[model samples]
Target: MRPLPGLAAASVLLWGCGPAAPRMAATPVPEASATAGVSSALRPTAGASAEPEPIPAGRASPPERYDDGVDVLHYDIELALPRGSGWMQGHAALDLRLDRAVTAVDLDFSGLHIDEVTVDSGPVEWHHEDGLLSIPLGSPAEAGARHRIAVAYRGVPDDGLILGETVHGDPSAFVDNWPNRTRFWLPSVDHPSDKATARFTVHAPAEWDVIANGRAAGPPVPTPPEVPGPSVGERRTWIYETAVDHPTYTLVVGGADMVIDTVGLAACGEAPVSPRADGCVAVTTWLFPDSRAEGASSFRRAADMVDVFTDMIGPFPYEKLANVQSATRFGGMENSSAIFYSQQAIAAGRDIESTVSHEIAHQWFGDSVTEADWSELWLSEGFATYFGAVYFERVDGMESFRERLAGAARAYLTSADTLRPVIDRRGDLFDMLNRNSYQKGGWVLHMLRREVGDDAFFAAIRAYYARYRDATATTDDLRAVFEEVADRDLARFFGQWLRAPGYPVLSVSTRDLRTGLRVEIEQVQGDYAPRFHIPVDVEVTWDGRSVRATVPLEGAGGVWIVPGAPADARVTLDPDGWLLHRLHGSPPSP
Candidate 1:
């Protein structure tokens, strides 16, 4: 998403994208910083924050994409959770091929009271050090090897990350926002770069319901005493699982009272010709009981948006999709399989229904095909930002569309820290690149659509989804898709917007010659020192009709002569407002 341009008295325009600096979280914490309070100086500095611990030297590796020779497969996870949030025990069966020998098995589990670790039901020597639960077997895990392991542990949960105190006061915190919360919640590699399928069966209180990514195969079952576990009446125990591989960041789990609803693909009409092919995938949303009042109204219209996005992009990847309104701090978070929304959604009423649309769109960007790293968050956030606008435009009108863009642009321009870039290599999940990634990114896309034409841009987006399904991508990959569709090089355009830190300020001056017309345009650097290559549209009323011409930014300020200058001419910086940059204009001189 792109930052909004400043709405100053001036009409000149400027634009840039990315976090100004990078920041890191020392511990697991929800990245729920108030967007209104974030400042540019707060962004993380490149190379300042440490990178994720590197993968052990010679371990079995996962493929980045579908390489011809790389191992590509699916997995299924089954888990059991004991009540009182004390401990979770489960037996995971891996049906995967190992390209090379796996010396050890590493899974992440923080604050767990681990009692035993075994392989294939046999007691095995293991270590619970360095936040990793690993089994050290003398023999190597042979290539194409398959194995099953059962792990049992007990501990008081870390109580999860404390984002902030909610109105209801349920801790209102979520894990993995800034730091990986899964280490406290589940065992696995806790990073976006690591993608896997997890199926969990949690045991909790009988009165409380257990909600997770995929639909509950069935109701939670009572645990027999044969298996050591927590006491009942104190908490409930249950089981949950899924076979879908998800970006670690998208993995989310929460427990609460729910208002469940199901919908089949047939219920929704046929997909539009212009939408994505996989858009027909059926989805479901699990709202909190408090959200039931407006659940039907909000989600009932979901099929329409799903159809539109599916046709425009690709089909939904999961078996069922859901939006769960929990006691979260943010407006909502796009978790894989399920989107966790804040209970505030209940009070927002009909006008706020679009929140659902925005989260749903994330299933494709942040969930399915994730950013390889947080730096390219613009791909996920910017795409979703624009998708939300598209949905609003489809449901509302052009006026509403313009209003939405204008609001976003206004927010972007007025942001306290406007110098940050959208793609921050060193920024954390909730870094200060919001304006750059969300607002500026959106504007960059809008500009691309204008430059390449809507037909090609959307087509390229569809192609991109088809090419990188269930994988990660960078800015170059995105540019490749557009280049393939437009049959033109977009390096210069994307480079200017994605790499550059600021924009250009255009000043327009004009004079009327008795025989023709003279127009002068001056260009100055906005936020950065580099001169910007911008497309300017000029309107002139000649004869009985209006004529428009496209001009380029020249120097600090330059003049243009309209050989057959119209009788009356008016200068417009960017008639389309495609660039989320500031603009300035000089007063007319007598």
Candidate 2:
């Protein structure tokens, strides 16, 4: 997800370049018994049954920190949306496997009226309050047992589902379910750790077009009278489904009168599975009619972006990709296969390619390989931020990539959030959207790439994605993969950059000696900051001659003496822009 415009403007000002792109509670369940057939990865962790520690007075705990004892496998949702009406009718059927034997199940849902609920097609008693829907199963279901539960609900949503007008004043409805907002309308596990394939059958006025996750089963079919719902005249049902498993936040539905265009196909290059047999994924754009020309032009390279990521990372994770211009609160929301961009940004013809690429990168990182815990959001946002710059590096050039990273570094250094670590533990889930998670997190990846050579770095990336493609991962999970591929332990590297706050602050001075040029470097970021291990690159130039040296600085300071050079030499630190650091004083001219 891209940051909002206000934050983007601040980023652009700091980088001195283009614009920047951009919860619920649950019930407790008994611990699961041992099962011989279940994969260990799918089973609840050892600490799953422990009660969460109470949050101190004002601090907000991470939203994804709860367990509900069930692993949802699939969701079949049917929604009834009427033109110009706030109320929506929905029927959601969830197929989930029990991790423990329990007589009751709890799901995250709120602000909607529950018409009915059935466990395996039989009526069940339920209770709803404080954002949870509790259902009594009448009998305990053993571990590994699978059950189908259906819920019929209706009401005007307070959030998650945005029912509003587009920039051009066209009536539209879009789902903004990032974090844990999916429960406002659709009920399920609603956590990133529990992923499930989904099928959406949406009923709307015939004039409206609907776009959702996965591929469309077929063209819109007239709504049959047998489908129970409020009388919305002349309605059609649009059905879409995805075989690939994804988290609830990425599941979405958008309905509006819009213009749709096909932007060619992206070659998947012998991927195990492709939308078509030819190994290609279809790329398209959906925009409000008034802004179709500009919006389509903005995403003209949508297909190319997919191809670039598919080549860099493993395969494209979804069947098809749709970039939609909608009424999303963020600058752009990476909603699995269907991405939603800010309607105003497209309508105003802003240069949003950076935002575009950022969201697209999330499909591979944030959407497919999700972060198990919200505290590990850098795994999502940081990957997208850096990979977005990498896209430009491939298509544009190295300079463009450097400039973007430089801008990001500047943004991080100047922001107040720099005081926090990338994997921050405190504050509201939304508060995690700081420079620490986005900019500094990207810098961490950048520096990691520099620490490990390109060969080892890219190899680790591919291996990590393949291992966690349809699952959750933490910073440690990533480190283990890199360690396995690079053949080295990167504990210090990740610790100083991610676990600790602030970057290396240095004060350097140079003086000419009879033997050569003398360079002194000192770490001056105060005692609170960790002493970083940095491989500093210093370049010296004099009389049309230039030489470079790498200085391994550890602890508080280090000195490097150049064996050759003149007294009148100019010095440059980190000339290649590999380090995220700050210079306290001017370097002395020899």
Report the lDDT tens digits of candidate 2 across residue range 242-295: 968998889999999876777768855634445577777778888776676556
lDDT accuracy of residue 236 in candidate 1: 40
TM-score of each: 0.75, 0.89
> How far does residue 53 in candidate 2 sit from its true spot (Å)?
26
Per-prediction backbone clash count: 70, 2
TM-score of 1: 0.75
User: Residue 50 lDDT in model 2?
Assistant: 20
List candidate 2 segments past 4 Å from native. Answer: 7-65, 269-273, 586-590
lDDT of each: 0.56, 0.80
